[model samples]
Target: MAAIQWTDVAQRLKWEATPEGYDRIRTVWLKHCDTELRQDMEGLLSTLTDDCVYTVLRTTATGATRQRWDGQEGARAFYTALFQAFPDQNWQPEAVVMGPQGVFSAVVLNARQVAPWAGIAPTGQTVSIRMFVYFIWAPDKGKFGGEVVYIAPIAE
Candidate 1:
């Protein structure tokens, strides 16, 4: 395979530049993001580094906002629980934009309520939710350490 350029990806994403030896950072970041957003939970779990940290900030039903996953194992457990909790949920990334620092240029996420999301029975609503995620990628760690919520909205 061709050599990867972490600097190029970082600049393109408008993050920050790192010294050498971290050139593979961007590869790790994208791979992880793609795996999760593509709903390949199994694929994502395998890519997680032992010391990796990932946080997901989201607004759940019952009008409660929560942040889950403090680290690699936390993330894995979160996804696992989520899948089991919402047994029939299907979350799809309708669109994505490359932003500075491994963030997105534009992020429009659409999720369908295939099963019970919260206390609410499956409305079969097929609701479309749009949100933006700002990413912070560290090359030394070879991971997207933190991702903040750039934007999200309450139900209309």
Candidate 2:
């Protein structure tokens, strides 16, 4: 397979903190993920720099799943499908943990059965999963460093 040019995800995601642009980025992320907002995400490539490598950590009481996105397209596709499938998705983030090089995040994922996810539709069933999502991002590289995900079932 041909390599995806560096310019692909690079130019899109700039690190400079702009009062309006950054706000827009946060809003887009929130709206796209929030069940109530249920909005279609656009220009996601611009959300991260080309060098950025997106990642997500999924942990459960039993085990965990770690994944890193290849680039802009990877992140975009994952987020799009994730939101679309679980329309009733909610995440409670306590705070953003910042590190010397990157940042970290802790969040709880509340995924409701509103539609078909992987051919599994809502039978009025619901699953509340508590997870810790860590995002290691870089200011200079204008990309994500890495991610750590942990999960456990929560009784709602």
Candidate 3:
């Protein structure tokens, strides 16, 4: 899989945000996404608060799996594992809603299964998974405090 085409995603995405919050989250989230695609760990961490929490929910045929990482250290560990598993991770967001509290996005996350992921064995095939992700925004701090991703893999 290739890196995300930010221009393409931006052109097609439908977005909305409160008058007061739009500018804040739009910049933060876009930078976060950009750094993520570049696989820049430090840049990625810069976009998040020091006390940030990251959570993932992967739904498979059998059941759903949940994982959570708290604080900067945990975030670093999570990203390290993620980059190792899927270096070319990408996402195409269809819609986004932002408010004073947080931002929610509906998107398709694409990545190659180069290693075991969410308990599934490696297939070395690109997979497009529908995901609803929520990003907690700390307006005062001007950074993301947390992120929650709910991934629903396509049924085979």
Best by lDDT: 3
What does the lDDT come to for candidate 3?
0.77
lDDT of 1 by residue, 14-112 (tens): 544554423455566567667766667867765554554444445554465445456667767766654544444444555554433454534553444
Compared with the true structure, the alpha-carbon lDDT of candidate 1 equals 0.52
Give the best candidate by TM-score.
3
| C-alpha lDDT values of all predictions | 0.52, 0.50, 0.77
- Candidate 1 error regions (>4 Å): 1-26, 58-64, 81-100, 115-122, 154-156
Model 3's number of clashes is 0
Candidate 2 Cα outliers beyond 4 Å, as residue runs: 1-40, 59-64, 114-124, 143-146
lDDT per residue as tens, model 2, 55-133: 5554456665555565667666666765666676676776664433334455665676665433234655655556565
Instruction: Compute each candidate's TM-score over C-alphas.
Output: 0.56, 0.55, 0.80
Per-residue lDDT for 4-75 in model 3, tens only? 257734642533456656787788888988888899899999988888888888877688888888888878
How far is 134's C-alpha from truth in model 1 (Å)?
Answer: 2.5
